[model samples]
Structure formats: C-alpha cells, structure tokens
Target: MAPQTSETEQVVDLNSWLPITASRKAKWWYSAFHNVTAMVGAGVLGLPFALSQLGWIPGIVAILGSWLITFYTLWQLVELHEAVPGKRFDRYPELGEHAFGPKLGYWIVMPQQTCVQVASTIVYSVTGGKSLKNYSMVAFIASTIRGSHHHPATYGVRSHTTAGQIFDVLNGIGTIAFAYAGHSVVLEIQATIPSTQKNTSKKPMWKGCVVAYIIVALCYLAVSISGFWAFGNVFAMPVFDMLESCLVQKLHFTPGRALRFAGRSTYVAITGFIALCIPFFGGLLGFFGGLVFASTSYFTPCIIWLVLKKPNRWSFHWIASWISIIIGVLIAVLAPIGGIRQIIISAKTYKFFS
Candidate 1:
C-alpha cells in the first residue's frame, strides 16, 4: 500500500530535482567553514569605501548592528526548519515554499537570488581585473594616501549637516548588507550536521555561527579600517585607481603619444570586457545588497517567523520581528538613492584606464 499523506502537509518535490544533499559525515565545524566561506568573499574589498561613507565610529556601529540582526534572523530560519516533524528544506527557496506557498516562494526568491549572483559577479570581476594587472601593493597603498593630497575636498569630511551625514551613512549600508549576506550557506551547512545524542549542550550549528562571525569580523575590520586610513574620503569604489596610479607613476618606458594611446585603448577594452554589465562595482554592491539581500537576509526571515509562530500582536518577539522588517525595508528603500548619487558623482571624474 502507498504511504498516507496528511491534509495539512505541504509537499515539496525538491529532492528529485535538486542536486544538493546533506552529507552525513560532515561535522558542525565543517559546516561553519562553508558559512564563513560563503559570507567572506570579494565584498570585503569595498569595506574601506563603505567606512569612508559612514565615518569610522558610525561605520563600526552599523557593521555590528547589521551582524547581530542578520545572525538573529538566521537563527530564526534554523528554528523554523526544525519546527515541523519529518520536514526538512535543503534550499532557501524550499524553505520559502514550505513557509508560504510554492508560488510566492518562486516569485520572492528568484529575483533576490539573481541580484545576489549578479552583484557578486561584479565584485569579483573588479577584484580579478585589478589582481591580474599585477599592481604593486606598496605603490598602490602609497598612491591611495597621495591621491587624497590632490583631492582634499574629496578626501576629508565634507559636511557636518544632518542630511549630509545621513546620506553618507546610507551610502555605505548596502555594502555592509552585502558583505554579510550569506544566509543560504548557513542553511546548507546546517543540513550537513549529523544529529548527536551523546551531547546536546552545544549545537554544532550555533558553534559554527560563533566561529564564522569571529573570522568574518576580523577580516572586515582589517580591510575596511586599513582602506579608510589609506585613502580616507577619496577612496574609489573598485579601489583599483590607487593601483593604476601607482603603475602609471612607475612606468618610465612610455614610448611616445601613439603607444600610450594604444595602451590606454587596450586597457579600456580589457576592463570593459571584464566588468561585464556593470561599470561601478561599489554602487552595484550597495544596490544589490539593499534591493535583494535586505529581503533575503533580514525581512524574509522575520516575515517567515511571524507567519510560522503567529505570536501575539503586542508580544516582544512580534514587535522585534516587525522592527527588523521595517529596518530592512528602510535599507532597501534608502540605500539605492545613496548608491545612485555616488555613481553620478563618480561619473564626473571617471577615467577608463584609471
């Protein structure tokens, strides 16, 4: 006889269609590594510029706040996965389908996923292009400092006006959100942890979160603080301007105007090819993080939790979840304005080869 089905149950046939599966042999630490790897990618490179926009103190606060918010929401996702009996979702979209209906899941996750991938690709392309050119790190660092000398207006604090500071802080929020937007990896890694009966005190998943964030925090602080210290307010989005300027300074073999023009043309062509569709790496990161990741990392989880638990309207958790959702929405709305403004400002002085 065929197995019976409960009327309340929602069927998800993902196992047959999806290639990913839980690995029984994997431990929690391994899962944590996956989480760390997922969250800590090319996004770190943009942190310096992000810091510049937000200011040192405000930037650190924002980073910590975002981390805590993201971490709490991630824990909600974990708890949601274990809420029902005999039901497990291997993918984020799968969890969405189970929480809502299949159709809502499809619409919500599809665009968000596309944006994340697109943003990540842009970040990688910019980083890779710079790396391939083999720019001297020391020269780049020095030039970054010196670049501030020529553009003093661009390098230091522009205004103490409330609106100006708000805009500046908003400009960096997208990059902050982007750097910490790897919730999908957490779900994947959690799936791999083998349930243990001998000791249940420390959940491997939680331990992994702890470890991963420590590493992520260190990396983010190091890169961001260093970048801001080196270039201050004049820090470029992709940050390759420093490297390019350094390279140009060292090039004593410029063989006349024709050769230089040819070289510049070739450099532009190469960058154009590598940059793919997006020319402004930092702006794209901010836009994508705000438009897509805010929902996936913060808003969606809170919504899902609210739906699943159906807490009292005035309860603490309910209020907290709503607050998070509101913050996410605000970030989604406000971040793009700052990103677009930054892009427009950048365009006024943008050079193809530099």
Candidate 2:
C-alpha cells in the first residue's frame, strides 16, 4: 500500500494542472507573440476611425502618448511582479491586494479587470462576426449592398451636429484608451515565464514587450494614416481561455476536460448572442475603453504604484503619475458619455443580427 501525505504536506503543482498556467517554459519570442496579440489585435484597426474623430494632432498625440505612457506603466507593472524578493504576484488582483488592503484592493481591481476582459470579449464577438459576414458575402452581393458608387471614404469627422462632434471626440479618447490597454495582462503573461533569483521574468518580458511596442507603433501609424477602418472583444479571447482553465484546474473545482469544453462553449454562445444583439463593436469600443480600460491601463497602476512604492513627492515620477491619473479620470468620465450617445445613434438605425 502507498503511504499518503498529510494535507499540510500536500503541495500541489499549479503549473502541472492548469491549462493557462501549466506551461511556464515559454521563451522570449513567445512573450513577443502574446504581447503583439494583446496590443495589436482588433484595436489597431479602430485607430484610423478614432483618428478621424480626433483629427490629425490630438489623434497623433493620443497614439504616440499612449505608446510612451503605457510602456512606462508596463515597466512599473513588471517591476512590481516580483517586488517582494521571494514572492510573485501572478495576477492583477494579487498585485492590487498587496498594494491596497486585501478586501479593498480585490474590490477595486477585480471589477475593472473583469469588465475589461468580459467587455473585450463581447466587443470582439461583434467584430469577428462582422468580419466573417463581410467576407462570406459574394462580391456582387457586397457591392450591391454597399452601392456601386458610395461616397469615397474621407478622413474628416463624420459628426454633423455640435453634440455629435463632442461625442465623437469622447469616443475617440475611449478608442485610444482601449487600443493601448495591454497592461491588464502583463503580470499574467509574465507569470508564464519561469523565473529564478539570478534571472527574473521581467528581463525577458520587457524584451518581448519592447519588440511588440515597436511593431505596434509601426502598425498604428500606418493604420491611422490610411482611410478610416475597423472590435475588439476578440483580443480578449486569450483572457477568456485562461479564465476557464484557471477556474477548473487551480481552483480544483471539478477539473476535467469536460468542464473546460462545456464552460468555453457556453461562453462562446453567450458572447455571440450578445454580439448579434448589439453588433455595434465600433461604437462600443469607446464605452469599453473608457468604462474599464482606462482604469486598468492608465490610473489603476499609477494608484497602485504610489501606494506600494511611495515614490518621492513632487518628483518627476510623482508628477507623471498624477498626470496619468487625471487623464484616466477624464477618459472614464467623458468616454462613456460619448459612447452611450454613439450607441443611441446607432440603435436608432440598427437591426438585430444585421
């Protein structure tokens, strides 16, 4: 008979059980791919349209500024991942808990994190479905529907009303916020890389992130310059995939292939149905971006950093953090107003599943 280890002695290996956390042997290039996917997915396509709304200067500044600020914030997050010599904060919530009180931090971070992931999924569902629909329809059918002599695409803001132009600008901010929001997944992605005292995960993670940011800068510049174009929840697909595996495997709550399959399929169906109902990913990007993305990407980390690191008051880092916070707060406030207005306008002319 085999001897059993006591509960206290039973140290389960999470990497072996969970689908998301199981494989921690990923190399630097793997991080590059993940970062690229997280940063440059459907979000980039929306930039041109966002550019149209903001016009050349604000749009350009938004893209360039976001690139810099997010990168800086990303670095802060990477540093915080293993801030405690022997410990790792594997998730955003964990980091939040460490910075804020356990209860306060969880409440503050989890809702924003969940909203970003879930809202991203819902937005992506709409985008993917629309893409498939556009591709599947015959060229003749598409031309017939779109009209043989539709107005040529223009870069000017499409808003005619004073109120609409204001809304458009607000939505534009949200779109930019949404486009630059990869910070939420940084720690999670870093967690996949094996770390040692001599060689920490941050080095490779930062390297991969640098590569991804370069690609993002190039792609975004091109996309924003070209004629206005393209959701986005599709970008959040990885987050969704990870969530299921984590729940079943790490949580030890009925872990099985069946559970994974059933959970994922149900998730797909629900998101799809909602997409069909809304089918306005473009407009909603602003809402999602402002609603949660700003919190996750912009101010949340700054807040967390200030709380945990206590950077010197009136210093460069301190001033920059405040600037980020102010910007984030404005986005959170105005982006939703713009997005909701956009939704109302779209709904007036929209058909479900169309």
Candidate 3:
C-alpha cells in the first residue's frame, strides 16, 4: 500500500500534469495585456444593452459591485494558493481539490470551468463572424446608396416607458456578470510573472488585475452608457445585433438590387447562417454568467475560504462570507430562469437575416 502524505508534504509535479514543462518567461506588461484581452471582448459591446434593461443608476452599481466582488474572489484564489504550507495552487480546480476532496474539485469546479471556457469560445466566434459580416454589409449599403439611392442609412432611438423591472434587472445582472469571465485564467497568469524582491508574483497579479479591470469597466461603461443614450431600449441584447438592426430598420429590410447579391452571398453565409446561435449570444451570456460565473466567482471562493480558514461563526468575516454566498446563490437561481424566459419571449419575433 502507498503511504499517506500530510497536507504540508503534498507536492504537485507540474511536468507530470502540464504540457508546458517550463513556465514561459514574460514581462508583467505582456501578461497584463494577455489578461486584458482575455477579459475584454464582445462582452463589452453588450453592456449597453444591459444598461438599457437595468436603469442607469442600477447599471452603474451592478458594474462596480460585480467588479469588486470579482476582484475579491480573485484575491481569495491567490490566498488559497498559500493555504497549504510550501505549496502553490496554479489552477482553480486544483485549489478546489486542495480545499475540499477530489470529488468537489473534479466534479464541480472542473466542469464549471470547462463550461465557462466552451461558452466563451462560442461567444467570440459568433461575435467575430457577425462583426465581419456587418462590416461587409455596411460597405455594400454605402456603395448601393451612392449608385442607386440618395439617403444614407440612418437610425433613431427607440424608447421604453420604464427603464426596467425585476426581470430586466436580473437579465442585466446576468449579462454584467458574464462580462467578468476571465477568472479561470487568473492563477495561470499570476504564475507567469517572475517574482522579485520588491515585487512578488502577487504584486504583478494585483497590478494586472487593477489595470485590466479598470479598462474593462471603462470599456463596458462606454459601450453600455453610450448605447443606451443612442438607441435606448430599441437595441438588441447582443449589441452587434442592435447595430445591424439599426441599419436594417433604416433600409426598410429590402436591400437595393446591387446590395442584395453581395448581401445574399457574403452576409447571409457569414451572419445569417450563424445567427440563431449568435442572437442567443446575450441569453447565453446571461445563462453562463448565472450558471457558471456566479458559482465559480462568488460562491465557490467564499465557500472555499470559509472551509479552509474556518473563520469563527457569527463573526464579521463569517457574516460577510454568508452574505456573499447568499447573493451568489440568488443570482445563480434568478438570472438563468429570467434569462431563459426573456429569450423565449423574444424568440417569437426573432429573425435570422434581419
């Protein structure tokens, strides 16, 4: 029989598990750029639609609130790495294993992490494809207008009587939560920053996080706030869709003869062919944020912290942890249900090419 090892004696061999035998040496700036790109993508574009659903005040609060919660949870993961003496956790699932038994780590955290990754790839692909298609379509419209028509494609704001209600708030929360979905890579990025006397790896991680998230917040605010200002509630959840819809509505859905051929060949093949999954982008973001992000970002870290640290019950730390857990659970439960409901309600009017 194999001998048992104490927590302090547990050693993970990176070469045995990881494909890369050695960590790639990189400057903190490079790693910071990687983190920023990973975190900020198509999701930034959708923030305005979220703001449309959430009122301005609530939308601002949600962005700030989620950012703080996300940063705190990220820091918790860092602390978890230091939990076992003389050992460091390089991955989220590994930390889960360290905190709980292998079952929770492999079964819960791993799957959630995988789902988050796969969903993110889908969002990126759809966004990229649609972006390309929109560019081509706009070019086609411009040429057609110059040749056969006089008026340029123009769009106007469509307003709602109310900013939003409970369902809208939930949807906005889910979408905003999804915007901060790079937690899975935080530890790995932290590991690549070579430690120095004045600057430990944690220093770079903290610096990277602060810089990246500030960019994220500003980018998100610019899109959501400006979008709401321009389009109001008339925009689609996926902001790309909102933009395309603006042009389509202005063009009255029938492309000029010259535009139709190009639209049918390129636009249809690129955007329309992929749009069922694409328009669902916003809903998927909401679903993923609630189903995975809340659990991984909010609930898991707090639970792991309490479990490993064993903070005293009814104390300030304990009470705060419990509150976080409850909020995470509530968002997880409410957001998905509301998101799916919104998707279904909107599907009746959904069009592939429009």
Local error of candidate 3 at 280, Å? Answer: 1.2
Evaluate model 1: give its lDDT.
0.66
Candidate 3: clashing residue pairs, number? 1
For model 3, what is the error of residue 293's alpha carbon versus the real structure, in angstroms, after optimal superposition?
A: 1.3
Which candidate, 2 or 3, has the higher TM-score?
2
Cα-lDDT of candidate 2:
0.76
Candidate lDDT scores, in order, read 0.66, 0.76, 0.63
Task: At residue 116, give the lDDT of candidate 3.
Answer: 64
Could you say which candidate leads in TM-score?
A: 2
Better of 2 and 3 by lDDT: 2
Q: Give a tens-digit lDDT track for model 3, residues 212-246.
A: 77776666666565555555450111122222333
In model 3, which regions exceed 4 Å deviation?
A: 1-24, 133-164, 195-200, 234-278, 314-316, 351-354
Which pairs clash in the backbone of model 2?
120-233, 123-233, 124-233, 124-234
The alpha-carbon lDDT assigned to residue 281 of candidate 3 equals: 64
Number of the top-ranking candidate, with lDDT as the measure: 2
